[model samples]
Target: MSSLPYLKKLNNAFTIFSRSYAFKSDLKIKWVRPEKIPCFKPEKSGDLQGFSNINKSETILEFQNSKELATADNNVKKLFSLEFAPKKCANNLYIKNMMSKVQRHELDFSTIETKIARWTGIIRALQESMERFPRNIRMKVTLKELIDRRKKHLKYLRRWDYKKFEWLLETLDLVYKPPPNHFHWITRKESLKKLTDKYCDGIKEERLKAYRLTLENEQPAFLEEKIRTLQFIRDEQKACNVVVTVTEEEINDVKNQLEELKKKNAESNNQLN
Candidate 1:
């Protein structure tokens, strides 16, 4: 059977376990009120291994254009040392305790791997947690910044060492496909092409729709302005009964504007189709 049908069933099982008497039997509850649960105390900086000041600096350093992760002497498998230990959960606990302690230039591949895994794991954990329980603005902001940092690292890797970039993706199982070209929006056609390419790749459908809708709604205004400009130029020509050079220029400008708008709108519609 497909896992989709059992998703809700598993979720309900988890919910029941969290709320059951057996689950709460060994736990201690400190309550502020009979019915209300108190807010959780936030962890301080460096409390989570990857969130430490030193770890942040080292991570930033590793993401620089010149620095490259060396896997020649370092075994990638040993990076997560606690994973193969007797206690399966010890890996998680060990990572939480030690990931932030190593410096960037420590010359230890295991430490470097720990740092990389630390941020990557935190990002995944936060994303999954938010999906299950929403309304975490602080965590959401942190996750956004974390993602930006991760992107910088990816860009640096792709630029400096393509091989390492591919290897990292394989090792981490990170689901990322780098763009064929860097995005630029200097021209309308360029913007449309980028959007069309993205749509072809099955990404950002809602954003594509919004872009097309904006162009569709705005084209009529351009047409109306073009008509008004043409009428004004015609009236001026009739009043003068001669070739009004300035009016001709104005009319041409309006025509050009309308043409551009129509071209963009048609292109957008074609992409949507």
Candidate 2:
């Protein structure tokens, strides 16, 4: 019957121990997965393909200002102006702006730079359209395919003609994001584990710092006790006329160290106050 109480007490103690070590619900360990960065980034200052002047009034097609249109009626001129032009016309202008001097011919659309520029124009237009209709899966798929194609072209250009690749990127204001050498999916379990480890490390470091401060604070008293013990041993040996192991020099050194430690502590305290 006495063992029953003992077993109950032991069980209670085990429960308390388990509760103490259990993960606390209120611990401030927070880990948020970063948003995935897209491979495409158009320039910041202009329309999606970085063509700032594409929408300008003076950027009309050459035919719009030809003698035929110049002599046409006012309504006809307004109808032909860039203000009334379709989005396709604006995209064409953007592509023309991206073309380099070496690839400016009308039929030179197969060059790497030209292909990238063409894809960039289409990609920007699709991106704008997607913004308006985010749930359009068809447009989204097309945009993804175009982005992948452009990335492939960029990769080839970078491998074959690095200088031209750089020039093309600068002209198009496009950033080429190469595929990662290794892909690791971000998971909640892994992130939480990493965060827990980091949090534990911080706690360990803080406790160690507090412990070091405690040892430092006790140094003066410990040194005082050591000095007194050494003095007593020396005095007892001298009175007994025995060989002295604790010399006056050793005692003086301990005293000096203790005095310096006190001075430092006092200065620190004064500073704190």
The candidate that wins on lDDT is: 2
lDDT for model 2, please.
Answer: 0.77
lDDT to native, each model: 0.55, 0.77
Tens digits of per-residue lDDT, candidate 1, 52-138, equal 222211222222333333332234423323333333244344345444443355454454345555666566556555555668888
Flag regions of model 2 displaced more than 4 Å. Answer: 1-26, 31-53, 62-65, 70-75, 100-108, 209-273
On residues 1-273, what C-alpha lDDT tens digit does candidate 2 reach at each position? 979999999999999999997856566877788876543334321233433446445435567449877788877877776778877677666656566443768689787788787777778877776767878888778878888888888898999999999887777766777777999999977988888889899999999999999999899999999999999999999999999999999999999999999999999999999
TM-score: which candidate is best? 2
